[model samples]
Target: MLNFFKKKAALVWAKKHVLKSGEFKKNSVKNQEALLLSLVKTAEKTLFGREHDFESIRSVKEFQDRVPVADYEDLKPYIERVKKGQANILWTETPEYFAKTSGTTSGSKYIPISKEGMPFQIAGAQSALFHYIAQKNNADFVNGKMIFLQGSPEMEEVFGIKTGRLSGIVAHHIPGYLQKNRLPSWNTNIMEDWEAKVEKIIEETEHENMTLISGIPPWLIMYFEKLTEKHGKKIKQLFPNLQLLVTGGVNYEPYRDKMNDLLGGKVDIIQTFPASEGFFAFQDDYTKEGLLLLTDHGIFYEFIPLEEYGKPEARRLTLKDVELNKDYALILSTNSGLWAYSIGDVVRFTGKDPYRILVSGRTKHFTSAFGEHVIAFEVEEAMKATVEKNAAQITEFHLAPQVNPTEGLPYHEWLIEFEKEPENLELFRSELDEQLRARNTYYDDLITGNILQQLHITPLKKNAFHEYAKSQGKLGGQNKTPRLANDRKIADLLEIYKL
Candidate 1:
């Protein structure tokens, strides 16, 4: 009976999702305006609503004139007030929970998740499967457990509101019927010790019929290794039924070779763009062109040109205004009281009709110290080519500019913590450098003109990144190793494990 309901749900959502995607393709401007108007109408009585004169938002321009784009820092005061039991400060009601994100230069951030906004997050997750069912038409995957490797759901309260990691918060909302089939039992799930939790998770799920495995790429790689050590075989031998591998939070390209070696088959991968702010997009099609944006969801979309970000008069483009193939810092106004919020993600539109995007990198994370201007997406793509060519696997890595402080020709340094070491490290380094040079004209000019040294690689000791993250109290679960750093702070700290 439960299986029947699950299949029915997937098929139902698949039809509805496909129809919506098509609807947005032909009527994006109309649908987007409707969504924005609906949001304004619903929250016209809330604090932000009253302050911004939401009642006056007859058009997108009026809405933008009333609400300026802001980052999390701009709203911290309001969040703090909410933490003190304030009501209707941002949303119509007080947030029922807060999603704790990684501490920044300013310290940790607690993003409020209001009652109306929770469904948006769940909808993205469901759409991943709906797309799968719509394309593949295989509902048997639902009969078995769809194990999601995420943070534990152990809740704590602050100022009468619950708080935890976003994944943990989502875990709590998993209905009991679906909960029974999930992995990492509640006891093991709640264990704060990451190493111990991983071990117990491996022990429990080593033999289960896992049809879907979803999480960030790096941590999932670690779990795959444990499964190999446990069963002395690849994932295919362990669970041949496994069909879908969904990844988010980081690029999956560099890990493709090692993952292919582990999974050993053509398992379809569905990528998603989920953030603590809100679940934004998902790969609805088989071809990896871009992720289909959820325009009709309870989120209003905006984009600011990367060059204009943080400027006093940055032009904010609504969905109707965004152009194709242009890099822009993505902003969102959501039902969750986050109005015109810059979530810090940079993306480029791949399609304009149905509205699809490819995440570029963080607005602050890039290297242009010498005017080369390298983005994280380009770096990852270069690394992917190098890794696949060399059959190497990277556990974790960080890149930084080596300036005149090093007392020689300045260069870019790549400190890599390798799990499956490359056979020829120098060749890997040279190839990766060349790949980037080919992608960026300015970078290629510097290399050809001898203005910069060839990129250098520092092979790190095993578990070096794990140790570093552990020391920083971010051993696992949503805390990603910074891929690109403007300064030597991350590389310098990880230098202890340099070979």
Candidate 2:
């Protein structure tokens, strides 16, 4: 009786979600403009707002003109003030929580989650699930156990505000209705050691009706591997009711083949674009290739063309000015008091009418070692094509330039952990190189000019990436291996695990 009621309620909520989303989609532009004004008005009395003269800003153009685009470093001082129990430094009120994230140059970043902005983050995730339920017209999954493999929910006090990983903070906000169905217990979640946590999770959930599983692809793959090892069966065989896989934080395409192989059956996937800064988009249509951008959310967005990124003359474009298929640096001015903040993500518009986007890559997470400027999208697409053609399955892969190789010209080096290696390794390498070259003209030019040689592939031992992550003390909880790097920091470390 309880399960029946839960499924009916879930279907009702899904129907309402679809209707609400349709209304927002039709008026996205107006919603964006109004949101910007509201954010500006709300923060007008705060330190950042006063400094930028937000009181006089009446239009999007005016706001853009008044506040320059900023990275984390630019706002570090303001965030520092907030950490020391300051109120109204950036937003109107003191932050309810700080979503701590690992940063490259800045060490640790503390992204403020405003009282007003945090609910939308939770709602975005709920809406993603609801969207799926609406499309499938089935709510059976709601009656079964669902696991979100995530960070430790344990938090520390930073002044009066709670501070923890974004995943951890979000874990605290799981809806009351879903609490009974969610697993693996709070004690299991709070375990800091990822390996131990996964073991506990396996013990707790092994016999349950795990109808939905959510996490980043790599970590979820780890969980799946552990489950299979324990049960001596494929994931689908163990949990026949498993219906959905929710993923985010990295591209899912690269991990698709391996994940499918692990599951050993069909399961729908929903990709989301989530960060400490905000929840931006999620896959609303299972048949569609792009995520539906949340226009009515607390965020107001700007797009800077990828080619013009970091240049003085870069144009900051609104939704109306954006063109389909062009890569742009995603910028945000949000109700959380972030103004013209460069989130460091690059996205491309797949549709205009309802505004769907694909996260292409990170602005900094690319290889430009030889002026090739290869982004994650290009490499992932290349790898996808190569793997499909070669009937290969990869566990994980990373690319870095071999600037001072022992043997020949410096070339791009791919360290790949293969679940199923291609029959002909050399042919696979050449085909991957060809696919990448076809996508990136600069790489093709370099190879044609003999300025650089074809990319080299290094087969890695099993659990190579796992070992790498463990070595870095980033074994789980939103940590992802860098796909491409200009330097050999990760590549050099990966040498020990080479097959």
Candidate 3:
């Protein structure tokens, strides 16, 4: 408990003193490179020493290309070593903490995190607010109690001293002073069971000053539904000072409208791109377009063309060489001693120099079952456009890729839960399909050839994903139903109807 308070105090101190260091504003790519080199040197001394004993890396590209594209499987050996109470191969010493989690597709990955890693998470988490302050310049929003809708604190004991998963470690590092009051205490303790944590959050916050809320998008949607149901109109009455809602962990496209409705459309909604591997970027602006990379912070940044990274014929690019509007897979040589680790995320650049990017999607978060590559962003766009045009009310939704071997008909199955059914869903779906096909030529050809059939809409009860997650014992904090489920196991869980 004292440690928690210390962390909170440190964070509050850092929040006032450390944010917006002029390093982030250094506009030139050269300046960015200089900043990265400095951080790399610092990490070298603090983490592994000057020689980098784990593996030799010549240049940024050489470091990237020579390293094989590995998911958590490749790193399992290192984790096993750590589990045996030995130092990991990646770094010589035991990490200050390890971000633990069962990855979306990879099951379980233990990411080594150090004391330096904590600041990045804290800074990135803080950036959401900084971005808001930069936009509105509102000092009032700065002082209020911001509620973080995060994973249960029970993760700490479950993963032990090492911060289990990125979110768990982040919870541990939340500035010590704010731990008791600002953050939801129930969710912060990893020892308590998930159900108990959720119940605790519900009980305490029913009459609290929850001005700012943060968490993964899906979990927030689920909790918000419950809050609305339990309090009726009393939600706004209880938390009358609420002004900002910050969500991440997944794309905010599907639930944006519903969240706005439930929050009375008064609060400014923000999204961030934070992960276990590292806090890559944040939506520093309101359009939620390009996530400005935290360039000057402890982590050094690098990108490789998605097509080239793993292929036999491939080359890599550094911060200096990345072209505008190109999609590249993310590779990081972080302060936590993860050298040239391919984080499986894909991002596209929007602004240059002090670079800003949009997290396009995960490399694996795509559907090519019909030879039509439909990424999460595309599906999200289509869903957003469809809902906006029909003026329909929707709480949340998911898309599952289906392949019917009998007809060889490959199409997308959309399981959507609407707050109110529009009068013309069929028309909405048809228009949405047209919009999607127009966006991607591959999808267009697939649709034209009938290789990809029409979208099948499946409406569910209002809190379906929430209840579904609850039933699975994974309801609170950072858990959310997959936005796009690719395989049979996921399909079984997400598919509400098939047509």
Candidate 4:
């Protein structure tokens, strides 16, 4: 009787979400503009607002003119003030929680999640699930257990506010009704060691009717591997009811083949764009290739063309000014008090009418070591194509420029952990090089000019990436090994695991 009611309620909620989504789609531009004005007005008295003269900003252009695009370092002083229990430093009120995230340049970043803005974070994720339910017209998953493999929910008091991983903070906000169906009990979740936690999770959930599983792709792959090792059965055989796989943090295409193989069958996969800054987009249509950007989720967005990302005269474009298929740096001004903040992500528009986007790469995470800029999207696409063509399954891969190889011209080095090595290694390498060269004209030019040699692949031992992550003390919880790097920091560390 309880399961029946839950399904009915879920269906009802999904229907309402469809209606609401339609309205938002039709009014995306209007909603964004209004959201910006509201955010400006709400933060008018705050320190950042006063400094930027937010009170006088009446239009998007005016706001753009008044407020310069900023990265985390630019706002660190204000965040520091907030950490000391200061109110109205970044927002109108003190933050309820700080979503702590590991940063590249900055050591640790604590993104403020105000009481007013917190609901939107939860809503964006909920809406993603509701969108799936509506499109598939299937709410039967609600009757079965769902597991969100995430950070430990344990939090620490930084000043007077709670501080923890973004996933951990979000774990605290799971809707009450779904609590009963959520897996891996509290004690299991708070376990500090990722390996131990995964073991506990398997023990708790291996026999349950797991209908949905959610986590970053690499971590989820790890969990799947552990399950198969213990039971000696495919994931689908162990959990026949499993219906959905929700993923985010990194691109899913590279890992899709291996994940599907481990699952033993097909399952619906939903990719989301989530960060400590906010939940920006999610796969709303299973048939579609891009995620539906959440326009009404209390975030006002701006885009800087990838070519002009760091230029002083770079145009900050509104939704109306964006063009399809052009990569742009995603910028945000949210109700949480972030203004003209660069989230360091590069995105490309896939649709204009309803505003769907694909996360292409990160602004800082490209390899330009040889004047041939290679982004994460290009490499992942190249790897995906090559892997499919060669009948290979990769566990994980990383790319870095081999600028000073001992006995050759400078070249790109591909460190790959293959679950199934290609039959012909040299042919696989040449084909992969061709695929990447076809996508990146700059790389092709460099190769043709004899400036750089073809990329070299270093086959890695099994669980190489896992060992690398463990070595860095970032084995789990939203941490992902970068696909490519401008520097050889990660590549040098991964050398010892070479097969």
Candidate 5:
């Protein structure tokens, strides 16, 4: 009876909140400007606010003229002060906690989690579920356990401000009612050993009526593999009522086949674009091609055209001025007190009627080393098409440009850890090479003109990336294998495990 009531409540919440997201998009530009003004007004007395002259800024143009787009390097001083218990540096007063990010350039970064920004994060989380529920008409989601493969919630404090993995921080915030139906209790969640945690999670959830599962795509694959290995049955047999999958942090196109195959059937997969900095976007409609940007979530957004991103005097546009299909590097200022911050992500607008977008790639995560300039989306699409053509499954992969003449010619090198190796390796390579050439004219021009060598493939030993990530102390919790390294750092690391 209680479970039925909970399901009904979830349905009702879905209707109300999904409608709210719609309304939020309808007034995206105005709401975004208002959010920026409100944020500026609230922080008008802070050091950053004062330096940027937030008090005099009454419009987006004024704000743009006053503040330059900044990355983590530019804001490290203020973040350092915040970590040392300083108040009103980046944010007004001290933050309630900090979301520690695993940055490859640095060890980790403590991003402020202001009390004012918490509700927006929470709302985004709620809306993720609500959008999924509304799309699939999830009438019984609350009746069964929803297993979220999360990280350790045991937080460490720096000058009285608690910090841990971003996913762990979010895990600790899951509402009380849902907690009752959540799998992998605190004991397993805080185990600190990922393999052991998986074992314990299988034991704990093996008998439960699991309706939903959420995690990064690779981790979800790991859990499914473990479940099949231990139970001697498919995922559908293990949990007959499993309804849907919610995943984020990496593109799912590459793993989509294997994930559904392990389930013995097709399952609805909802994508989300949640980051430590903010919950930026979520899949709001089944009919929509891109994610609905959560415009009202205390975030003010700006976009830099990808072509002119690094140019000193390039232009920046707000939500109202963006065009469809052009890749734009995203910049944001939030109530969390990150001003004119470039989070390093790039996205493209897909639907302007409701401000829907697709996360195209990262600002630094691309291959332009010979002017081939291939992005993550193109690579992902190429890989997907190649795998489907070859009938294969991928476990993990990392890509880097091989520029030195040691190999006789410059080419893109792929280090792939496959779940099942292809029947004909050379043909798989050929298909991928052909597909990429078909997709990107610049890449094709290089290959066709014989300016660059053909795609060089190196099939890796099992768990190559997992071991590499472990070596880097970045093993789990939404941390992905860097898809494209700026140079040979990751490629050099993977050379040791070449098959």
Candidate 6:
């Protein structure tokens, strides 16, 4: 009876708005801007009224222009002040949760999250999920079971506080809201309680009809492989209903072929762009080329030209003003009290109205040592196409830049492990190099000057990247194997051979 009420509520919510994500996507920029303005007013009342005594912004342009840019480092002092049990610089109230992220350049960062912020994240995520379902007419799939391999419960504490990273916090709320019968009660519990988690997954494998699965690609690949090994041929018979797969947290190119083999075929795959900060985007339709932006959500979006991150003349445009096909650094101002926050992601606009985009790569996740700029997404796509062309299977891999000592050339070196070594390995490497150079002119220039040379490929043992990530104490939660290392430290650590 309790579950019935929950499902009924979810259905009602779905009917009210989620079913209209497409309509909402078609909403004009002028309408969305109006909605954003109204929400910003409400946010001011909700968050800053008591703290800064902010009544409202004098004007829309004032809100965008007057608020200075803030990065994670700038928030550190405010976080530290709150840690000492004092009033924070931004929010007057104490944060109910802190979503942790492994700092890209540093060890770790804990972003303070308020209760209001949590709901926005949840709403954005659910809207994205429903938008995809509605677009594909796959509403029937939601009635089935989904198994999300997630971070462990042991991960809740940071500096002795009972909490979790953003992903875990989101997972912690899933069971309460979701229809009980539709979801598998079986949880992997990937957190610190490994012994119990393994036992639980093993026990649940006996159940039939697990229709969908979602998790970090790397970890899920490892988990499925382990399950296959444990159950042998009986594994497929155990969970027969899994037809759709969702993966995020890392690039899926390296394990693409291996994952298809594990799943038995090319299952319907959807990739999501979510972070400790918020739900940036998600695959709305399999047939679509890009992710549809959740425009009605509380986030006010801005973009800065990619090449001009720190330049004073770097053009920043609001959602109503952005141009297509240009890569731009994402800047977000949200209801969570974040003002002009640099999210460290680069994206290109692919469509408007339902605003579609491709997450190009991180701002820093590129190779620029010898002027050969290779972004992560381009590399992932090139590798996937290469694998398909060669008809080969790759289990895992990492990429790093290698500079020629004598010629001063900078060429990319790939450390890969294939299911079966291909006959044309050198050709495959050349194809990838050529594709990259064609995509980014910097690589072509570097190659022409002997500043970048022929690419190198090195095969590794299976489970090499998984093992490496485990060794680094980065088993889960927004952690990824660095594909392109800029600094010599990580480059040296991941490099297989010297140039």
The estimated TM-scores of all candidates read 0.94, 0.98, 0.85, 0.98, 0.96, 0.86
Residue lDDT tens for model 5, 1-499: 8877888888888888777667776888888888888888999999898888889999888998999989888899889988889998887889877888767686688888888887777788788888888777776767889988777888999999888877778787889988888988988889887777888888988888988899999788888988898888889888888887888888888888788778986577789998878999888787779888988888889999988897889899988789998889999898888998999888999998898899888988998899877888888889999999898988878889988857577999999988878899999999999999998899999998988988899999988888898888667667777787658988999999998
List clashing residue pairs in candidate 5. Answer: none
Candidate 3 per-residue lDDT over residues 202-256, each given as its tens digit: 7767777777777776666556767887778644565787877777777677777
Candidate 1 lDDT, tens digit per residue, 91-187?
8788988998875764878998888889879878887778888888776677675667778788889988999899999997765756777787888
Q: Kindly provide the TM-score of model 5 when superposed on the true structure, using C-alpha atoms.
A: 0.96
Cα lDDT, model 3, residue 177: 46
Which residue runs does candidate 3 get wrong by more than 4 Å? 1-22, 31-58, 104-107, 154-163, 186-196, 405-408, 496-499
In order, the Cα lDDT scores of the candidates are: 0.84, 0.93, 0.66, 0.92, 0.85, 0.66
Over 4 Å off in model 4, which ranges? none
Query: Model 1 segments beyond 4 Å from truth?
Result: 1-13, 405-407, 419-423, 448-450
Q: What lDDT tens digits, residue by residue, belong to model 2 across residues 1-499?
A: 9889989999999999898889888888888999899999999999999999999999999998899999999999999999999999999888999999889899999999999999998999999999999999998898889998778889999998999988889988999888989999999999998888888999999999999999999888999999888878999999999999999999899999999989999998999998999999999987777999999889999999999999988999999999999899999988887889999999999997799999999999999998998999999999999999999999999999988889889899999999999999999999999999999999999999998999999999999999999999989888888898989999999999998
On TM-score, who's better, 3 or 5?
5
Clashing pairs in 2: none
TM-score quality measure for candidate 4 = 0.98
Please state the error at residue 75 of candidate 5 in Å: 1.0
**Model 6 clash tally?**
4
lDDT of 4 by residue, 1-499 (tens): 9889999999999989888779998999998999899999999999999999989999998998899999999999999999999999889988999988888789999899989889988998999999989998898898899998778899999899999988888888999988999998999999999898899899999999999999999889989999999989999999999999999988899888999899998799999998888899999887767999999888999999998999999999999999998999999998777889999999999997789999999999999998888898899999999999999999999999988889979999999999999999999999999999999999999999999999999999999999999999989877889888998999999999998
Model 6 worst lDDT window (10 residues): 45-54
- How far residue 311's Cα lies from its native spot in candidate 1, in Å, is 1.9
Identify the candidate with maximal lDDT: 2
lDDT of 2 at 438: 98
